[model samples]
Target: MKKISKVFFITLFLVVIAVALGVAFPEKFETITGNIKSFVATSFGWYYMLLLSALVILAIFFAVSPYGRIRLGKDHERPDFSTASWVAMLFSAGMGIGLVFYGAAEPLFHYMSNAPLAEEGSNKAFKQGLSYAYFHWGLHVWAMYGVTALSLAFFQFRKDEPGLISSTLKPLFGDKMNGPLGVLIDVLAVFATVFGVATSLGFGAVQINGGLSHLFGFDVGFTSQFIIISIVTILFLISAWSGLSKGIKYLSNANMVLAVILLIVVLVVGPTLLILNMFTETFGLYFQHIIQMSFRTAPLEGDNRGWLDSWTIFYWAWWISWAPFVGMFIARISRGRTIRQFITGVLILPTLIVSIWFAAFGTTAGNVQNSGVDLTQYATELVLFNMFDQLPLSIVLSIVAILLIGSFFITSADSATFVLGMQSTNGSLEPPNTVKVVWGIAQSAVALILLYVGGLAAIQNTIIIAALPFSFVMILMVIALFRALNKEIR
Candidate 1:
């Protein structure tokens, strides 16, 4: 009985146009997007850093202030899912394949190649590298998602508005949200979600191919990545057809179990003492330097500035790009919780889990490098598996990692399809299966096109570009959210 709205056609048209351009003129598409990406990073890098820091502050204030008492829905409405399931689902969707893709790779990259401040390959670099990884994947990123989700949940559940991004701004804009401006806002959200999720799907496909190549000596290239995406697309489509409770919920729970098993294995076999020490020290370091790191945009021309643009700026943009999809999905699962409960769970707990995860995998990879093995020599996708090859039960560890990545990939793609369907169908709770299927295929097609055009560079370039306009949209959301909350409590 559900009907697709105009937003569906408009967004789909935009996506088709983009995919066609990429397919027909791959080089030109890559060059143009890369130029724009560079301009954004160079020109507005400070804006991103400042905005993300402010959002982190706002998130903390909402959690601890009296506003914390406000429930997302009516006071008597209880959460539909239990605490554990809620946490599992959000964590799986929020950081999923990125954690596995970068767990071992990022920290090692910093120590050997970049290291924000420290000299490459030094003891200081080794220690500082893990701290940088923590910074990139920590509270600042979550604050973006937290603020977006809070606004959506507040308006949609609390104020009985349509579950659309523009709906959150109704207080300031009034019925104008019912017109073209609202359509533009919704269209932007859908566009950002499509690109953001497609980029992650590309990562999943590339990493899966890397794992297969590392294990079975399969060739690594676009062709292999194509096959991987093809197989996974079918799997996630089947899961999508199964609906949220049956497909996504089960997959999310299974992801946590598999991820934990992999973590324990790495901790037991790789470098337990170093991991424990590194985690304790890096946890303190990350909090201690959190303020400085939040606003650290290197102005002077050098490697530090390049590192900031490449890693920090890119991550901020990537998180913003994902805000629409992850935020709405979180809001959908997060009714009946207090503002404090939602913020704490969304911002704090996952940060801790990921910090530990990075500590275990990163420190092990670093230790292996220190022991005379250069993990940097391997491709980013192959780094985790190669790092495992240096440890005990290497084959078992590699197999488990690939499985975990596969499950996380499926969970993320499945969740994105549901979110996209909801966004396109006027915020319906149960979007039609046909709409979901169209989105599933569309997401995969974007991933494939991006891979075909410029691989990882193209993905990062498109993410930075797609996220910029939405960053402004998020600012409006925060202003609208605060206005609504103040009026309610008054």
Candidate 2:
């Protein structure tokens, strides 16, 4: 692993140098960026929708299989955290900045450009808008996390291989993983996670800064970003140092409470009737056209193709990029649950909650747009402050928004810190606290630097590029996980 890490860093340095040089020459960089985007757009295209749908089906099958009876840890032992605590961590880490950013924007985006299944400017817009948000937040996204957590719980906690991604692949590679092959997989997972979580950090910083600026009437700048990062780093470091039982357990529970309060407040104060109606219709649409929407790929020549690429493909790629962190975090919390229990906890319950959030929040935002309570002009700005102005109760809503963003950011950072600690210390079930603090601080520093450099878009693009290698690694992980499950059953 150390050797692989060295090689990876060296290669990364070279790539950074190349990119730096490219940046120095604007025309050259623009050409390169365009070519890369074109390739991704064309190759990934509509097929991603079908591919993601297949993955969701596979996860459902695994959830129901006999091997799902296998439990993590000792058969008789109780779990470390309460059910609520466990669920909160799973939801927070899995959802992260996504829920905050997409909560308003996704529905509004879809409302403007209706789904392929809906007529242009039809009444179906509101339903289809929420439907798309739920789809992105639902079973498929959580399933990615489920597979990762299940692999770790069974192999690391139960079977006693090290609690790292490479060890999870041991069922497929056996002794081969002890050498170069294993190190390579671990490197990919780590690098992917760093980039992915960093992207979340970037987004969280920007949004939080935006909210604070609006709430306090202060100017938004890198100073706000730096302050948020500093606070996040300190909080997560403290959490990491306290270890899972004391730190993570409490944080997750607090996060859930805050989330529920925000949700309930929005439900009561916003367009309650409109939200309920839209939610019911959206749920119906989601289930009614599940097959078609899930697998839809408009003809290459049609207008629907753009919408599919922007939303569906973007979502799949985002989930894939986030799989490592989410998987490892779930694995950490799922030590005493059966595979079926793990699946239900990681996939089913979280999806249901996320869908509800989108139903309530997204629908309210859409109603505001449709009813002209606000022009929805700010949604286009991609800044949370501007976006908040579109709603009626901007002040109260902004507070809830800040809490939601801060808690989720902390949730993700703390979990990543714990996972990185475990991975670095030879994958011990309870790695040393020092390791966690180190990684937590490192993540914050990276986030701060990314924020200072070019804000959210730069960080996101960097993460997407870093995630390219891990996309293949996750596919390999699925293969290895199934092989392990098959061997266990046999």
Candidate 3:
């Protein structure tokens, strides 16, 4: 483990140096990274749908198998959080700011552009809009997170392996993972998670800053972004240092309550009929076309292919990028759950919540757009803040929005801090609190730097790149997890 750790960190330090040099000498690095991203985009774009379908199939298999009965913790140990609180923590950490930022904008963007399933000049745009929103927020995305969590929880709590990515692979590699290979895996997981969470923090910070700027009429700039990151980092560090029992459990409960209240307000105060109709139709479309839509990779034969690449492929990659951090966090919280329960709770519940959000928020935005409410102007001018303006009781809506974003960001930050601390401490569940604090501060610094460099897009691109290695690692992990489960169950 010591040798592995040294090699992994040395490699990471080299990569960091390279990234720094690339930033300093953009003329060279830009060309290199651009080419790499383009290659990844094209290669992965070809089979994005197929990959997603396979993921869903795996999810279904895991949910129903006897292996699913295997719980995470010792036989006598009980879960720490109630089911409701557990689900809430999972949702808040998993969804982060994407639910808020994309809830309205994503549907509208698809409505104007038309999704793959929609006919040109068809009035079925709203249906397609909601469908695509759910597509982005639905099962496959959450399954990626579920796989990681289940792997970690099962290995760490059940097998007494350290709670790290490498330990999850032990069933495959056995003691081979115990030396340099294991350390390399753990380091890669940590690096991927840090970058992923930093990306979320960057997006959350920008959106929160934009929302505040709109409410208070302040100028939006890097300063506000930095301040938001700093404050959130501090709060999350405090929570993380306080440990999961007190800090994370309480914050997660509050987050869910706030989220539920916000959704109820939207349902009652917004366009009730439109929201209901859209929710039903969208869910119906999702179910009806589940198989077809899951595997619809647009052939590279026309201009329409660009749309699929931009949206669907990008979403898959984004989910992949987020898997390590979200997966690790879910694993940490799901110690006493069966595989079936874990998958259902993490994948299904989050999908339901995200679908409802899109239905309520997206339908309201769609109605406003079609009804000549001038929301398009706000959407175009100030995309983040405009969604709030369209809601009934705009002031209250803004407050909810702020709370939701803040809560989600803090939850993610806290989870990532805990995960990173565990990784650094050789997979100790009760890792040193000081290590957690340090990682929390490091994540904040990375977020602030990324914000200053090129804002959200830059952070996103970096995260996507960082995810490349971990994506392959995850495929191995899925195989290993199933093998371990089968061995244990039989």
Candidate 4:
């Protein structure tokens, strides 16, 4: 305790207590978190949208301006990983399970209802649904990741500061970056990360278990979910111990390959032309309505505005919760790259892949519904597997999906622990193996506890509630990055 930072100990202590309370008193905890989630979304949703939009605009300005020429590290530094591997790691870590989880469900939910601003059950409504999918998983979210990475990378690699959230704020806080406020910032980051990662792991574990049940007629309950968490925890810990070069890098590379294989299989096996046409149509519709979507809010109709809070606002908060962990991991691997390159790589490629991914999977699912499949009968947890049933060899494909989510689960948790270890240890580039393992365990423990307590919704609502404060931290981060960049390049 003496050797370690206050940020690590205090954050971990608080997380354990919260998880213990949640486990010891599950119903009360769920009620409290659900209320908090609603309160935050109802009251401060504009903040989430405004800040996220600012990040998207900020990234674009930074990329197109002459400042784009600036490298994240030293002047002569070169990229650490090949482009393909780098993009792979970026998508695998940044989006993780959430992307695949929401691919179909989100769009279908939107399609089931008319947009507050669009016609229902018409072509406009269809476009609105697909557009909502792209919007939720679009450039704005990546802007959060890109800008955070830029600040941390620029400060740590170029300016020689500790690679912590507080370090990026030195331009504003000066010596206070090393003071109590700094500790608080790091503590908030750790707190949010713990719950955020757990929420994701909880989601993946439940979904994977559902797939297992669907594929092999196995039981789906706490027992199976706990085993999934335990297996993933151990696997990711070993990968975390193995470090970035061998375990994470190789897993990320393989993740991309597997993702592509599954994608091609889906495209070929599903409605190929429909998928392609949907991609083209949705991509255009999303862009045309991008400005409207970015600033969209409904204050008049109670139900209309309430809908936005549930879907759009919740998504914004979710991405903000995730940005820090993903930002740090991307920054760690993205040494020796230019600001333009890094921002574009972080922003464009993943968003494109997501667009294509949704088009392939989501379009197929929606088309199947149009053919009188009654997909709405399936529960949300079972929706993806049910979507696969529309194509050939669903059992085989379901197994592949389970494999994909399982690997993605391990890879995401592994990368997050690597970053968390660094944050807790004064942002060491090479955090100790022991520290990495412990952080890995803490992450898994939170996930397992949440799953045991109330399954997916409990963890989901809790993470959204946790992100409210951290969203402010990211807003500060954007300001800090702008100040740091202005000073460095000038």
Q: Could you tally the backbone clashes for each prediction?
A: 0, 0, 0, 0
| Per-candidate local distance difference test | 0.92, 0.71, 0.76, 0.85
Model 1: clashing residue pairs? Answer: none
Which 10 residues in a row give candidate 4 its minimum summed lDDT? 114-123
Stronger candidate by TM-score (1 vs 2):
1
Report each candidate's C-alpha RMSD, comma-separated, in the order given. Answer: 0.9, 3.2, 2.6, 1.6
For candidate 2, report its TM-score: 0.89
The ten-residue window of minimal lDDT in model 2 covers 1-10
TM-score head-to-head 1 vs 4, winner? 1
Report the C-alpha lDDT of model 3 over 1-490, residue by residue, as the tens digit: 3112352355347446654754576455545555676677777765556666677778878888787777788877777678987887888778867788787777877776655756632458778888888988898898778877788888888888877788888878999887889878877887777777777787788778878878887668888887888888888888998887778778888888887888898789889997998899889998887777677766657547767766777777777777777787788888887777888887788888899989988887777777766555553225635765776688788778887889888888898887777777777777777767767876777777666666665665566577677888988998998888778877
RMSD value for candidate 4 = 1.6
Off by over 4 Å in 2: 1-37, 113-121, 379-394, 452-454
Candidates by TM-score, descending order: 1, 4, 3, 2
- Predicted model with the maximum lDDT: 1
Report the error of model 1 at residue 470, Å: 0.4
In angstroms, give how far residue 42 of model 2 lies from its true place: 2.5
Indicate the residue-level lDDT of 438 in model 3. 66
Error of 2 at 247 (Å): 2.1
In candidate 2, clashing pairs total 0
Model 1 TM-score?
A: 0.99
